[model samples]
Target: MDGDLRGLLPDDAQTRQEPKLMHPFKNFQLNNAIFAAIWLVFLAAVLVQVYLGAGYSARDKVWMTACVAVFSAFYFWAFGSMESHPSGWSQFSRAMLRWAVLLVIALASVPVIKTGVISYAPYLAAMLGFSVPWRKSLPIVAATGVVGTLAVWFVAPEDLGWSSLVLFATPFLLVAVGVFSQYDVSRYQLQHELDLAQQRENIATDVHDLLGHSLTVINLKSEVARRALHNNAEQAEKELKEIAELSRLALAEVRATVTQMRTPTFAGEVQGARRALETKGITAHLPERLTPAGEHETVFSWCLRELTTNVVRHSGANTCWVSVNADKLQVTDDGSGFSTDTVQNREGGLAGLRERVEAAGGRLIVRREHGLTRVLITMSGDSELMRDGAVVQEASE
Candidate 1:
């Protein structure tokens, strides 16, 4: 059980400390599989045209038939490789290799232009649409257009003129537009993934906060109860009762925190935080309601939990106040004050809170002065601000 718990903990604290890595290929399986299948179908059609009497010479049929088989195999292999690793660059390189090979075959048609392989232009265009990324795909498509035009222009000048270039290049133009559209789709998909990741991080932090403070209070109280047990059984019994009630509240908070990210509103989170703080014997004052909390309720909830947890654990305060206004939510505590400089030197708790606060285009302020330690968190309207930057500010005087 201990081993399992340790394994479940974030890797080294350092690795978990860093930002998550993004996938290079974006949608991976869906996109790759769809494109690969399209390429395979197109190759099959090419094969039919070659062998099923599309007016090809015997040699022309053989080369086109060979190209079709090779293209299909390459599509399957590249798609599988990409599926294996969507994040790393290795699979992308493999996909590129297939594109290069197919391009070479299409370019080779120029030298053997008399072979009547020009009908397979659609297959090459399909590869462009399905395989290459926009930056590379665009240039390659243009090159293919140039080479294909030159192939027909020079190979059989009488039968195929410069005008034939446009006819041969029609498939590639269509494929180019399709590839661009897919790129837009991919961008939107990436944004959605990022939003989901942010939500997960918020949820994980909530779990950590909910359980962490409850356990700390329970431990402290249990110790107090244990010491009292030998001397005063009545006080010991009282403490144990408090522990039981606190445990139940903690369990409820855990459930609430898990569901909080999905169904966050200002009221629910504020109420949960108030209950959590009250159960821990920390006085909490919150707004009746906050206006225009927007879709950023999850972020604000996370900030509230982290600040409150810090108060219970580090601030040593008997009282805490939570205030919500136009764009800022603040937490203030009065306790045995520590040096503002000292708080900056520590990790794990306050720093993480600061990160979470600042990630949402909000700011975090930690100050110790005149027997009070205050943590003020401010969030602007933009959620993207939180995803990019999370700063650690110097504790105040």
Candidate 2:
């Protein structure tokens, strides 16, 4: 029930490939832009103090304002370009350069900018907090706090007392909060991706199962209808109606499979394969009582159909036997069978089948001797076997 609810929700981010918009670069740009805009406004406030407040020397104020304006302009241009074409190294270099240049200028203007001893330290936190990783950002902010303290001790009016340490420490708290928040957001996005991938896989499996069974049924009923046409018109018409109904059901199954609401079962698959063999004039021997173990049924059932189809098309034999045990199944036929080289020429289906069976911790064997072709398939590790025996009586070759 919980898995159904999870499937109903938007898939978890960790499993799915998120579109490019959710990429880390996109998120970085947004956070960087916010921090840059805030810093720009803060610089403007500093400019106002430099010009109107009596704390700065006239010449020193002019130099500080020009330096800050240049830094602000470059900061905006760098971030804007990166937003348009985001490259990690370029963004990283630009961020580091922007913060370094701004920090240097602020350090130079400490005496002339005429704000409190710790005023510029808050801006440092805001800048690094948004752009750099927390491990790096924390140390940078901490160092800025130390510098702000020393500046207060050496440069502030000596009359101000030791209580001024509070001013230096406060901005670091804001920086710490911003860094932690960004980390949390990144983790949430990763989880969302994981959920989405699982949903897509489940949907694909459902589609394959639905289409495989329905198509086989349609093929069977249409053949029965065609064969009955020459013998009895009434029986032919009945088969045609059954075909129409089967077609409608197949369409409904296709739709449900697309939405991932339903999947094929072992019984349905065996029935479809049996019908397919009968339609093609091949005698199929399937177990009257058979049940698969858990999810292994879905994969092993597919193997049965593929193997049966190969037998009817490739082998020139009129008698076959299908035997299923608790853990394995075998198919044998009397036919003029080709060598492994000839099967290899038929597009590596045997090799692919081998891999699929091996992945499920099973084994497959194919050999021909004494005018008899035999396929011995064994599945261990708690998997129920599904097998079909078929013989081809006529062939173009």
Candidate 3:
């Protein structure tokens, strides 16, 4: 009666390739205009030279301005949306082409601006962070840092000549970009795995409960109809109608539960179990009143649904007993016994129930003693949870 829907759909996330995280620089990447405005300050020497006619003709300034404009626009677009771009030859080609463009601009700026290569070295290193994986980018970034540091030492800066701060900062910036980008990628992937695991667990539990109890009830009704067919035609006909209605309702429930996922109410399950047990000629001991369970209500509802289904289908009991305290639910039956094997081996819907309980920080136990079987569940060590009342035992065989 339980443990059947475990094969319906395997988690697709298990086989999925790690999703690429949003561009490592996504958070820090400013708009194109802003990025250019800030970095353009570094071009003060070139702009001053162009204004005063000190170094050369004005044409060099025109070329440098065009290059910076183009680089800033392309760099922002590429880095901000790297994650959305699909992977494969096409993506790699595009990434490489963009990196090459930036490298050309960086090199072209050197002789025109006379700041040496270190003026644009930092930008090139940032391009590497997005251009390739960290493993490849870090090594190249390290090389650029070493080269930049040496160039800064040998060539006097006609551009921003701040000295040692520039020397230490240049290399550190290169490596920092690579590390942070990789860190964002790793963090995003771990969060995705967690979401997938939680989704798989929810589907596993609901599918079993929704299908198992419904089918068991349908089977019980069929048996009732069969037994009454010859001796009581009117009763048999009523049972047939109920069987039809139940089938339709169960089908609807399966579809709805799968579509959005739902939790069944504890009150509804209690009533359902009562009707199911009555059909089996088993007397039921039920709570006289259902005071609110507040936050714990949903889990208690699922536990009752699973417990009643097992009792009606598996236990050959004359009387069914159920008790609820604040932190515990104990269902006892005068049947053969509850099988520990189902739990030990994780056999059926019972196993799904166990998972649901444990996920909510509760544990389930089943024991057999002197021809009576008892199943008890405790949550959060709070024995006062549902301790409002006791069950009113119905007289039985």
Off by over 4 Å in 1: 1-89, 104-116, 156-175, 178-181, 184-192, 208-232, 255-397
Residue 345 lDDT in candidate 3? 79
Worst 10 residues of 2 by lDDT: 388-397
* Model 1 Cα shift for residue 229 (angstroms): 6.0
Question: What are the per-residue Cα lDDT tens digits for candidate 3 across 248-343?
Answer: 998898787676435655555666677677656566777632444557777887898888878888888778877775677878787777568867
TM-scores for candidates 1 onward, in order: 0.43, 0.43, 0.47
Please write out the lDDT profile of model 2 over residues 162-182, one tens digit for every residue: 424444455567667777867
Compared with the true structure, all predictions reach lDDT values of 0.61, 0.61, 0.65
Indicate whether candidate 2 or candidate 3 has the larger TM-score: 3
Which candidate would rank higher by lDDT, 1 or 3? Answer: 3
Q: Which pairs in model 3 have colliding backbones?
A: 2-349, 3-348, 3-349, 325-386, 325-387, 326-384, 326-385, 326-386, 326-387, 327-385
Ranking by TM-score: 3, 2, 1
Question: Could you say which candidate leads in TM-score?
Answer: 3
Candidate number of the best lDDT:
3
lDDT of 1 by residue, 92-135 (tens): 47556666776666555433334355555555555556555666
